[model samples]
Structure formats: C-alpha cells, structure tokens
Target chain A: MSSNTDFVLSIEDLTVSFDGFKAVDKLNLYVDKNEIRVVIGPNGAGKTTVLDLICGKTRATSGSIKFKDLELTRMSEHQIVRAGVGRKFQNPSIYENLTVFENLEISYPKGRSVFGALAFKRTAEVVARVEEIAREIMLDEFLGTEAGLLSHGQKQWLEIGMLLIQDPELLMLDEPVAGMSARERELTGQLLRRICTNRSVLVIEHDMEFVKNIAHKVTVLHQGKILKEGSMEMVQSDPKVIEVYLGH
Target chain B: MQVAMNKLFGGREGLVGLAILAALIFIIMPLTFDIFRLNLVGKYLTYAFVAIGLVLCWGYGGILSLGQGMFFGLGGYCMAMFLKLESSSPESTKIQSTPGIPDFMDWNQLTALPWFWEPFHSLSFSLVAVIAVPCIFAFIISVAMFKRRVGGVYFAIITQAIALILTILIIGQQGYTGGINGITDLRTLKGWDIRTDEAKYVLYFLNGALLIGCILVGRLIITSKLGRLLLAMRDREDRVRFSGYDVSSFKVFVFCVGAMMSAIGGAMFTLQVGFMSPSFVGIVPSIEMVIFAAVGGRMSLIGAVYGALIVNFAKTFFSESFPALWLFLMGGLFIAVVMLFPNGLAGIYTSYIKPRIDAWIQGRRGGGNLTPTVPAEPQDPVSPRTAERTPASAASRSLAAGIQSEPSRS
Candidate 1:
C-alpha cells in the first residue's frame, strides 16, 4: 500500500442502493493520478454504479468518496464537475442539434457564461486548443458537422474530447467503446493511452480485450461487492474472476 | 435558379430566406395593393412581431404560451389612451367643438384621468409602457410558475385563463376601458394624419424595419449557447437541471423578451388600425397568436413570419368569403398542416428540396453510384487511457452475450 500515498481518489466502503436493493456494496477502491483503472463486473454487478457514485449521479448511501482530499459524497453533480471530475454517460449526452464545434465550445468552462459565450472574442490560443483536440481525435474533417449526424463511435470520441476540453482532473467514462467499430476501437485505445499521461481515468468497460489493452490495473465486482483487484493479467487468472466469467 | 430556390427554402437558411421574403413584402405589397390592403398588411407585420416572441418562448423555452395577445392588448391600450386624450382634449381644435372627455371617461363622470393613465399621456411614456408593462406581467407570471416547475398543459391553461380574465375586466370597466365598443376614432399621431395614404406607407415601412430587427435579434440568440441549452431542455430537462444551469431563470428571461415583443406588436397594431378593443385581448386572439407560430413551423424564425402571413391571410379570406365556416377552416388547416407537415412550411421545403439537390449533385458526379452516408462520430474522441476494466471478470463473462466477444483478445 506504499503506492497509495500517490492515490488521487480514495473510496472507503461506499455503498449505493436503489430502494432496498444494494447496487454497490461497501466498495473500496483507490486510483492514483495518471493511472487508468478499469472496473469490470456482470450486468448487475455495479461497475457502472460505482462510476455513477463517483460522478455524483447515484449518491452513495453510507461510504465516503474523496477526490484530491475533497469529500465528493456531499457535492452536487455539477459541483463535482466543477471540482475537476468529468463524466461521460453510457448514452452520449451531447447537444445533438448543434454543430460539433459548438458542442466542444459548450464544454469549455469559459463559454458557460451568458455574456462571455456570446460576446467573448475567440482567442487564438482557445482556437488552437479546440483544433488540436479535434485533430488528435481525427475529427478535424467533421468539426463543422452537426453532432446529431455522428455515428455511435464518433459520438463516444466527441464526448471524450469534450471532457478533455473541460480539463477535468478526474475523468470517468461508462462503456466508452460499447458501440464503436473495430477500427475505431483501436484508434480509441491509442487516444486513451495519450490521455492517461495527463489525467486520472476510470473507465467502466465490459470488453476484456480492450481492458487488457488499456487498463493498468483491474477491479472485479460480483453481486455488489469487489471480487478482486490487481493487475489485469493477475485478476484475469484469479479463480473467482474465472468463475464469474465462465460460471459453474 | 435551382440553387437559389434551395437556398430560399432550405431549413437552416432561416436568416437568408426571411430577409429576402421580408424585403419583398415591404417593397411589393405597397405597389400591388391599395391603401386599405397596405394598411392591413402593416398590421399583419405587427402581429408577426408577436409571433417572433412566441417563437422564442414556446419554440425554444418549451412554454406553450397561449396568451401573447394579452400583451399586445396592453401595449395597444397604452398607446390608445395617449391618442384618445390628445384628440378629445377641450384645448384641441381637431373637431369643430370639444368632444368633451372621452366617452368612456365621461361615462365614469369623476374623471381627471386615472393616475395610471396620466403617465401614458406622453409619447415617451406610452412607448416605455409598451415594453415595461408586458415585461412586468411576464416576469411576475414566469417567476411564479417556473419557480414551482409548473409546466405542460397547466402553463397553457393558466395563461389562457389570464387572457380571458383580462378581456372581461377590460370589458366590464366601461368607463375606464371604453367597454366592449373599445377605443377608436384616433385621427393623428403626433400631428401626422393617420388617415393619409403617405402615413399608411410610413407605418408599413416602420413595421417592416421592426420585423427585420426582431428577426436579427432572434437569429443571434438562437445561434448562441443559450439557444442550445434551450433546445437541450426540450430533449432532456433533468440533464440540464443537473448540468448546473438555473433552468427557471432562462425560462423567465425568454418569456419577458417574448412578452415585450408582443407588446411592441400591440403598439404597432394600434397605430396602423386606429383602434383597440376587448376583442383583441380575448382568448380567441390569444389562441390565434399561438396558431400563427405553430402553423409557420414552431421552431424556425422564418416559419413564424410565414405562419403570421398564411394564417392571417386565411383568416381574412375565409372570414370575408365564407364567414360561417371560417373557424372550421382554421381548425382544419391546423389539423392538416400538423399532420402532413409537422415542421410546417419550412419543414416541407427542407425535406423536399435541399436533400434532393444534394443527392442530385452527388449522383451527377458519381454517375448513378449510391453514395454511402456515414454518420461521423463527434469530433471529441474518448481517450482509451480512461477505459476502466470490465468488472464482469472471467467468471461473469459467460452471462453477458452481446458485449462479451468484444476486445477481450486485444
């Protein structure tokens, strides 16, 4: 646990339930800065629920969640966002009717102002930042296109780019490559690699290969509790993990 | 010609098409139509101002306001009161002898002009009143309703009831409000003879200018971030609520803006028509304003202009020609248009024109090859570094079917 000193996020026995049904039960996890930690679970095993709790979507019932030593359990969703925690929902939650560039513009913290967004002069640096991000994601050609016209894979990329522009310290994504094509998924894997050098990323993915490709560490959840937590290869070899994946 | 036609009717070409059409109306209507028709068109343009406001409120804010006509009436009354006093004053020489006090005020008997009406005696006061009164009413109502999150049919019902009550109150206060007969016989505006043909054209041009201004402002706001937020609210309101925006504040701002625009239309209506009445403030007129925005294409600014003209034209034609079945015709028009063209006339042009032209151009270049339309993913790509491990683990992988086969071997 010596490496835990560098941990940016610490979740101590967090529990979240809908009505009486516990979704995340006494979940304990820690994510170090600049690390890609993957959370994998069965359909109802509460992998997404954990991300939801972190992002302030589903409030934790009893456990404390802290980011950068700030208690996140009591903060509003937007407050969490403003506190440098960004989230991308499983279903893309972008303004569909707006152009792709406009969608990115909204995610920029400065443009949220009523007067600033309208009358604020676009500086060269901001323009470069937007262009740089767009090019990195291979979206330069589609910058002017309406976001609604994007394919599922493109939307996932765009959502990720949006978070990047927000410049959040912690980025939580739920199933980022669920609907992406094989080629797009490979590109996305590289894109995520580049991002991990800067920000702490927590991705909730079901794709084991993608997880193995990107995840530095993996956590397994079964029936609302953590089944195992270790390196991807080690957890993949664990008998409990094998039983959850293969059954009987 | 084909390109021009597509540009004119294309859905997103709201600003361009509206500019061209408005210019044509301002120029052509005066030449082809007589003095009366020209004046009528002037009044219609004023009504279009109200439609623009309604477009901002209901189209963007998702508030189904059915009482814009009430704001129109408020502005009309403000202007009418000023004109009434100037024309009917004993010191005036318009009539051979003094008309004494206005008929409504004389009937009240104890009149030295109500304290509220005193400020409206000045042209400046009336002008400010036109903007202020409606804004105040909108602010009060919106604050109360939106703060409580009372929306949907209840919002519509409440506004409609306000219109009905205002009309009855105006009509019942015969001495003060001029009763059901309403105020008429206004002869001049700041000494310009309103009856003159030249004056009529002046009013028409003034209205045309206002229409352009309204369109430009609406266009600017719609393209802004606030507009995007408004549209997003329509799609996923709870998401917006959690996004840290005060949804009610935005709603209130839009409502006040819309109400002020409607009030300006009312002031213009009074100047052009030389009258104001309880009938204009009633539920039916309020409903007509909603219909004007709805039939034109609820979401498009140009559609509001088109709706104003088409619905008003239908009203004039059917009322004069058929009279008995005019209401039925309007209702039928509403049903037919809503069913056939959900996006209204603007929707019709876009769906039938722009895509075809795009397809035809693509076809000519490729010589009949079908072009594959790929949905481009949004420009922002999710960083793969952020991928969390699938908690499904080896033991749980067998239970999930659709996702289990993906990327596990990578």
Candidate 2:
C-alpha cells in the first residue's frame, strides 16, 4: 500500500506477457541509491526481461516502475533514458562504423534532438567529457580506432563507457562480463564497483565468482519471479537458489 | 585554418573530389558538349540531386527509399503545371473549348482548372510547391513507417509501391495529370522563352550550380555530429535509442530532406527537358535513381554526382547504339558494381587509388617527417587490400582521422 520514495528505483508487481506466456511476472524489486544489485538466474529466468521492463524496451502488462518518483512504464525508451535510466544490451552494441571517440560522443546526452544534433558543435566541454569517459573505460588510446576493430572486451567497455557518458542515475547492465577473458572480467568487476559508487547499478550476470566481487546484494530470479534475495553469501547458501540456479 | 576547411568539406580528399566534380560540370562538360548534349547532361545532373540525397538517406541514415522518382515527379509536375498554365493563356489556346486551361485538360473535356492546379498560376506558389509537396509527402511516409520501426527491405518495397501507385494515379487521371504523356509543351518561364539556346545554357548552369550547392549541404550534414549519429543508428538503433534520441524523428528529417532534394531535381528536369511525365515518376525510374547513388558510391556526395553522370551517360550510349542490349547492360552494370565495388566509384578511389596516391605522396616527401601523416594511417589499421573489401570503413577512416585530429589542434 505504501511506496518507498527513498529508493532510486521502485518496481511494484511488474508483469509482462508474450502471447500466453509471462516473461516477467508480478516482480517486485527496489534498488537503493549507490547500491550494486546483481540479478542471477539460469536460462529463461527472465533476468534480462526485468531489465527490459524497467528500460521501457518491453511494455509491462500490469504494475508500475518508478524511477525517482517518475513513472517509467508510461515513457518511451528514449524518454526513459533521458529520465536517467541507462540500459546496456547483452551484446556489445557499439557503433562499428564510427571511431571510439565518436561512439562516446554520440552518447554524451547533449544534442539529442534532431535539430540539436545538427547544430551540435564539438565544444571543448564535450571533447573533455568524452576523453574523461574514454579514460575511465580504459580506451583513451583507441579514440581514433574504428570501434569495429576493437577486441570483444574493449567493445564491452566501450558500451559501458557509452552509458557512463550519459551518467544515468540508475544503470542497467545486461551481462556486462559475458564472453570476456578472466583478466577482462576482473577489470570489469573493478570498473563496476568504482562506477556504482555514485549511482544505483542493476546488473544481470551469470558468473557467480564475478557476481561475488561486485554485488552489494544478490537477487535470484526463477521462472519470471524472484526466488531468493539477500547478500551474496546468503543467496549462495539458499537451498532453493542452489536447486533452481547455482547448482548448475 | 586547414582544419576548418577540412571540417567544411569532408577532408582534403573531400575537397579534391568536390573540385574535380565542379570542373567536370562547370568547365569540362560545358566546353566539350554542344547545347543539345549539354542540356541532356543538365537533365542527368538533376538526377544527381536525387542521388546525393540517397547518399544521406540510404547511405548514412540507413533508410533505403526506392521511390525518389515520386518526389522528383511531384517537383517536376509543380514546375510543369506553372509552365503549362502560362503557355495555356487565352490567346494561345483560343481554338480549344476552354481558352484558359491546359490543352490536355481541354482535350479531356474539362471546363475549368482543377482546384489543386489553381495555385500553380502564381510563380512563387508553384516554386514553393515544387519542394513543399514532396517533403510533406515524404514526412508522412517516413513517420508512418519509421515510427512503427519498419525498415530495410520492407521500407524499400513500400517506397517502390508508392512510386507505382503515384504513376498509376497520374496515368488514370487523364483530365487532371495529363495522363501518361504528362504536362508537355512548356514554352516560357516568367515570359522568358526557355526553349532558346541562351535559355538552355542558363538553365544548364543553374542546374549545375544547384547540384553543387546540394552537395555542399550534404557535406555539411555528413560532417556534423548528426551525421555520426546517423551512422551509429544505422548500425545499432537500440544503442542510439538508449542514448536518449528519438530515432524516428531523425529518420523522418533525413527522408524529408531527401524528398526535398529529389523535388528540386524534378523541377529542374521539367525546366530543362521541356516536359514532366509518368515515365520518370514510376518504379523503374525510382530504382534507376537508386542505382545512380549505388554506382556513384552511396557514401560519397561527390561520387553520387559522378554516378548519375556515368550511369545516365552509359544509358544514352547503349540505347543509342544497341537499343536491344541497353537494358541487359544496365542490369549487368548494377550487378557488377554491387558485387565488385560495393562502395561505387568513391569506394574504388578511397580503397585503391587514394591509398596509392597517398603512398606516392609520402614517397615524394622522401619518407621524412612521417609522424604528422602517420596519424591518418593508424585510423585505418587494416591493409589496403582488406580495406578494399569494406570500402565504407576506408572512407570513414579518413573522416575519423579528420575529426580526431581536431581536439589535438585546438
């Protein structure tokens, strides 16, 4: 009955269906400010769908998603993004045809409108910001490198850098370390921990070891619903979580 | 100063390309061809306007519109209607039943001018309609399709279908649209006889100047942040959307720009060719216009102009000599260009010729002080042979080099 305004993101009984099957069903989640919440699930647990529902990539059949008291359910994807909810896709989705600097500049959150983009100048402020983000993502040297030529790990970082430039209040990263090398995965964990200090981060990750390193709290999703939620140690030890997901 | 100039054009390569194109259109072609041949070249240059537009829409924005001819036809018809009305004055058409109406309308037994055609009596209104009509139509189509997220092959088919529908409508409405023959016998423009050799020369120069202006405008767009966003959106629409952009609005804007450009070409066509017809407003001509963009290197504005000139010149050459083989040859050229040099002439230049020229230039510089020029090389890490396969990357590599080198300078 009572909704919490203190939380950065509050999702109450969110449900989404395709045909007759519910991909995300009656899910209630709340993310606190400056918290790193990791969602772990086996295949078909609707972890990605939960992110989609929040980012407005998929419409919910019922329930509400509130970001800082703003109803994200009624907004379009871009509007939701502009409202400070940034989503990174499962794959590394950088613009291959552009340079790394351009990839970062495109996501700088300025000149987003049609006319704005046309009139957008590469001001020193913009260039300085782009350079800062590129450095944070460990891609300062590759500014002129064609994004398509980057390694899989670099591309993933570039996508994260893209989201960082927007500086979204609530960040949703879908499998940030998937297909990454062990070194890359560790660096990503460090990157995640550093970046989440200023804003809430909702990560959908499958790797348990990586999850332990970055998760302030862990939520186990099973069949469109949360099976367990607690600290990483608590969720790892939960029998239901083990049987449904971690056991595999 | 050099950086500012590079920014104004695409880069040094872009400036050279523009200069070469200007020479061909303004100096070489004018000096070589007689008025009749030059008029035909001017007509082809009008199509260059449409091709340049396609470079932005289809090449950069990644929205393939196969119905450019419809906009071109609309623009040409607007100009034609004004010319037709001017030529159809009471004294000129006194023998017809309706002394002040177009001959085709009078022949079809129409007693008065259609309400739609009434505004064409004013030169200013017709001139505005030449761009406005097609842009409004393009805006509607882009919004309807792009808002629904329909794209790629489906979008192309829908545009082609619209072109066909417009052609059929023009043909069926014999009374209103001059039927399949279109609005013809255009004699004067503001009481100036446009059929004279002097008028032809003036119109040819005007069309050339306009095409160059359009290319410059296209260059401005391609070098802007918007152009980079278009490239980004084409590759990753979701990424751009999540970056807080209304993707459909950009698509609609570029499509409308493309439509406006095609309309200008059409109006110029009517002025230069002395007619506007359904043949140039249908599916075949629409696809042909796309080929012009494709063959010219869809990614290159200057290349599109050259593409229009090359393809149309071949069409005239083949059709004049071996009329039966022209169609087959045209098809073969399209196939060969797509398969071999996918980036068109611009691709060939960037991938093969430009690099060789660059290497020679470097060689001539005695390989000393390679550091300044080496910045351009790192942007394109791939070998020239590999770059040849993905010509767009090679073209954009230089573009990126120009852009990346800016912050350092400042």
DockQ of each: 0.12, 0.57
Clashing pairs in 2: none
Each prediction's number of clashing residue pairs:
32, 0
> Runs in model 1 with CA error above 4 Å?
A1-31, A42-80, A120-124, A216-248, B1-19, B58-63, B84-115, B140-198, B225-251, B350-410
lDDT agreement with native, every candidate: 0.76, 0.88
Candidate 2 Cα lDDT to native: 0.88
lDDT value, residue A27 of candidate 1 = 80
On TM-score, the leading prediction is 2
Chain B TM-score, candidate 1? 0.83
lDDT of 2 by residue, A168-200 (tens): 999999999999999999999989988987899
For model 2, residues B1-410, the per-residue Cα lDDT tens digits are 65456656656667787788889889999999999999999999999999999999999999999999999999999999999999999999999988999999999999989999999999999999999999999999999999999999999999999999999999999999999899999999999999999999999999999998898888778777788888888989999998999999999999999999999999999999999999999998998999999999989888898899999999998899999998888889899999998889988877667666776788788765454433245444342111211225546465555555433210
Worst 10 residues of 2 chain A by lDDT: A141-150
Q: What's the distance in Å from true for residue B377, model 1?
A: 17
